[model samples]
Target: MKKFATITLMVFTLLIGCTPDANITSPDESTIKSQAQLIKLPALKSGLKIETNLTREKYINGYNGGSFIEQFEFQCVTGNVIINSQLNFPAGAFSGGKTITQTFNTETASLEFGPAMQFNIPVKYTLTVSGLDLTGINPETLDFVYVAQNGSITGVEYDSITMDVATGTLKVTNAKLNHFSRYGFVN
Candidate 1:
């Protein structure tokens, strides 16, 4: 089982990262706030990877509303991320040929966006996929609908950042972010 993976979906740099409100404690705070704000944005939806093997035809009590049936295995993990946003799974959602799920082992559930420093402040969020259980379904005719009740974002840790847009260069010093504010963002 692979412990960590980052799947890039598209090339969205400026759209995802935020524009700060110039009222922070300092430049460092302003930058970190910008990076951490990604999770608060709807764009975070593009960064999740969930797949499952369970079908709606059966239940733990029984099959087709019967008296006795079986259940399948389940798993979800967290990596070096700052924190895994708790997502609520949708209710009574089902699709004929689609599934969504995620599996994790005995890990702290910290979704490390990447080395943590650069990942915390990302130009784009890459949504990698997890395992899938395709049984008796044709790949061509596969079609189903699924939704995650909640979503998540990667964690960040950068001591300081220095950028020179004129020359297209960014320098991160101290390399470890130890503070952040978990607040709401305004549109």
Candidate 2:
């Protein structure tokens, strides 16, 4: 399964690379933000099965902590188009904090922002998994990044989530570009 996922991501990246470098103007900030706001991400809907795992990290000074990874295997039937992607939870459950979702319409980019946390507080976050409804582009070529309130987190401001378009699984945790093959512009 791991090998298959690696191959699938490689293929997706190659597809993106093959696209001719056409002069495509990037969308404005306001436009992207507006589209992101217009779109609604339904709360993990009912009748859908969700699988989660909890991994613990033992701290030497008794600061031991853990992370909960939750994933949803479902389909988007309400929207005109359906995108398949996985959502990753870095911190854990959202018992308190804030959560926000943003999408770049023209670039077809979407992001989820979690609450801001201080030094003593641990934060929870949600990432757009495999399927993001980017209007026209195939879910396979869509890369993901989570932009959250800045403060005590390490790595890039936006967490890059990996999307295996073929298997419909999000493999990576933390913000790092998934790096995949481009499949060309959507018509």
Candidate 3:
């Protein structure tokens, strides 16, 4: 009888441990901090030019059912700024094989991911910018922004943003992207 009681108590404890907390709640839009700021890129001078780097139609197999990771580095046309970026797709994110493309617009400091489609699981975009002048700017206020094709700007919801003053690098980590669009950094 004592052994049976002990076994029942252990089962109850296991069930309670596996249960999720009822007090947990998702933050509403108002409770979430906004990371976007309205800004415009400076117009390029006649001597300056808009340069772009394109990675086209990289094929990834979906039949194998595995995570996919890709890395890209883009240099700004105007200055010494460099953006080291990565994209991570989890298993079963999509069906069948697909082609992915990325484009870096140097003049606007924006990145575009092609064949724009929504994902079942959020695609994580992590970006680190180097060689940028952060003088007089609050690094904490730096965040990623989404630029529309019509030039409308909006804030990107990011998991975290950090700055390394010594290395002159600002990193936007785990920015959840539902669909591909033009993304850039703003103060």
* Candidate number of the best TM-score: 3
Q: Rank the candidates by lDDT, best first.
A: 3, 2, 1
Q: Model 3 reaches what TM-score against the true structure?
A: 0.62
Instruction: Give RMSD to native, each candidate.
Output: 24.0, 17.5, 10.2
Q: If both were scored by TM-score, which would come out higher, candidate 1 or candidate 2?
A: 2
Q: Rank the candidates by TM-score, best first.
A: 3, 2, 1
User: Worst ten-residue run, lDDT, model 3?
Assistant: 30-39
Using alpha carbons, what is the TM-score of model 2?
0.29
- Highest lDDT model number: 3
Cα-based RMSD of candidate 1: 24.0
Tens digits of per-residue lDDT, candidate 3, 2-121, equal 999999999998887666652235643323324444323333444644454545446755444343344444333334555677777766566677887777655444678867777776
TM-scores, each model vs. reference:
0.18, 0.29, 0.62
* Backbone clashes, each candidate: 22, 23, 0
lDDT of 1 by residue, 44-75 (tens): 12345533222222121111111112222233
Q: List the residue pairs that clash in candidate 3.
A: none
Model 3 clashes, total count: 0
